[model samples]
Target: MDLGIDRQALVPVVQQIISAVAQWIRNSGASPGTRLPSIRQVALDNLLSQSSVIEAFERMVAQGLLVSKHGSGFVVAQPSVLHEGQWYEGAEREWGAFVDNPMGELKLGCGWLPDAWRESDDISYAIREVTRTDTAGLFNYSTPLGLLALREQLLKRLSQIHIATHLDRILTTAGASHAQDLLIRTLLKAGDCVVVETPGYGNLYRQLAFHGVQLLQVPRTQGGPDLSALEALLQRHRPKCLFINSLYHNPTGTSLNRTVAERLLELAHRENFLIIEEDVFGDLQHASCTRLSALPHDDRVIYVASFSKTLSSALRVGFLSASTVIIAQLASLKTLTGFGTSRFAEAVVTTLLANGTYRKWVQRLRKRLRTQMAATLQVLEDEEWEVFAKPAGGMFLWARPGVGDRSRVQACARRLGVLLSPGALFSPTGEPSDWLRINVAYAADQRALALFRAMGPARSTSTILKTTSV
Candidate 1:
């Protein structure tokens, strides 16, 4: 029970207690089901408050290190055998674009922001406020449409982007993935043709394939999907839907220009196909950035967005806006599959939005990401890397060395303790590629720079391709 709590250390008392207990259990070879000292006894032995002991115990239980027995107190739980490498075993790794990087490795290709960059104050306040004020949020399931307050806030947000929608057309989801799943289930049948970008979101490709849909990949140009190729596909195949990332497209970091957006809508209307616009990174762009859903023909576009990229990923709150009919269908499917999204998480997001904390935080995030993007681009230029496109604003920067084997580049990344997202994983068919999806947030790290530096400079002018622009 002697945890040797360092009261003067910078780490919190609760965290220290949790670490000490975990280490003790590991070193002493505590078996599963072994009961631990009571909270009162631990507090007394360590000269700490019972609240601190209880919090530490609760955190450990949440981490699966301990199990809280109703009357018997906390006991050790079975140790996990899954290591970080196992998370990316085979196909899982290719589709797991948002998975956390292994400990001590630079997540140069990861989706979310680094832990240090996240603002904890507003989020922490929201969590505390929700827990204190909303009792039902903590215990009950959300309504079919979602928490009313959160939906209202989302509606306001949509209006700012010029996307007009009512509360009945908004449906909360676990995340953008969940929204996509519901849409796929509600609108698509097996063997239906769906148009996806060649270098698109890998997870979406996997999901559509799993649903037994026929994938028709259209080449993605800097401005957006190649209109000529897309038009050709529409003529050749009667696709049921076209999935697209309108703003800050994943991997490529490109946005759809107004001209392309108009053309896409026209095609959707002509081809009799739905357009599922994934705007998860829309908030990170300037307010004036073009969106398909913001256009007058929005009925054909089902808009899906989430706060996971800018806000905390742990807070899996997302929403989709569509025609009332589509929303009703999705809501029913959501209720049947998962009951509903998290009411508590929705409440927390609502609190942040209502108090204007989320708006200010996103503004700050956009500024920081812009700065990082510039720095990372400068470094890539200095290293003579071929950038796919210089995004106006977003977390991703797709680039590759002017000359090198893709396998060698990956091996170099591993040697430098950096994790990278290979471009092949972004392809619909999983074709071999030399391109890489670099996260601007992590590309500035010295470890990431080391990997770039190792690749050396572009060999010749002929080797470098023309940089695409929006």
Candidate 2:
């Protein structure tokens, strides 16, 4: 086959063989089922060891580039086509679509921070330390309530935020989404009514819909949810639960005020509905913020938070705090659903938290996000875009062009290879709107700047002021 083997190169011999064989298959016009030279023959022809040849072939087979048949040697495999509908097929997708963007495409609407913003030294060190010190974490499943040490760390964090709770009331899950799913499975049933924000998290809307729950959406205002609208919905339908983002809301970056928090609690008590407060981005805020779970309630509030937003997403560490009764129920469901979260990941997070690495890391992250957010907001203002609210701290800014049509804005973004999170995706009904969720971390990129600048100047100063007053 004349596979090129470079002995002096830094690449290992087995990897080199794998690359050469793949290149040969592509360039030689080899069709499916075409067999290459025997492993022994290739080893002899290339002046290499048979072990290297066998390892390369096995690796190739595992990669779906080749298939091994019983006593027939390896043959080229058919090219695999990923089914479009297998996953991320609908408009409800947010993160999946962001992740699937083409290389070099600017992700201006992504949920998390850019790669350059992530500080990996502490996380990497924690991973290595866990690998060296905790053998049981590597092999065993976490307990029903998750690792005790990790939960203890979480308890300290909760205390900092003033949500006093004991270890029995805390339960760790894969992430906030997993925690939400456990709550849904344990507390809700099909045909139940749940109140959600109108322009809120798309993934949560989809999750609720998947469980056959009817969603009653209340409009989210600059202060918080429109209390009048929420109260009106409560009058007609008796919802079982109300899901809300208490701090740094997903798309708008709005934090709940103390007045709103208290009122929401009162309504929850009167209406006999549970409130699930999601605080995934709460850590990024520098000032103290009101949390629904922190307020006095009759065990009607469940708080879910995760390290995925500020920390490494791959770590998949998150926890929920609630009444001991609710925690016990959710923990049992968590065991049945996924057994438990990764003990290794929990251990790594514990190490980071115990050594104070996580606190210092988030402090730096908060400062960076604050600076980027100011710069991005300035750019938006110069380009005459209308911002929904000027966030105190966090990564998102909800804004739209002040002059151009929605279609023109989208077309310009496409031409500049900029991915945007259109307002429609945030709606529970998939209803279209002009606003877009701009992630400040990527908004400073040249491509995103160009797209925003292409919208031209605002039509009128009065119009711009009226739209952006919130």
Candidates in order, TM-scores: namely: 0.78, 0.79
Candidate 1 scores a C-alpha RMSD against the true structure in Å of 12.0
Superposition error at 59 for model 2 (Å): 25
- Across 89-113, the per-residue lDDT of candidate 1 in tens digits comes to 3236333323632235677887788
How many angstroms is residue 349 displaced in model 2 relative to the true structure, after the best TM-score fit? 0.5
TM-score of 2: 0.79
lDDT of each: 0.83, 0.83
lDDT (10s digit) by residue, model 2, range 329-444: 99888888889899999999999999999999999989988999999889888888899999989999999887766655654565456667888778887776899999998987
Give me the displacement of residue 390 in model 2, in angstroms: 0.5
Give the Å shift of residue 396 in candidate 1.
0.5
> What clash count goes with each model?
0, 0
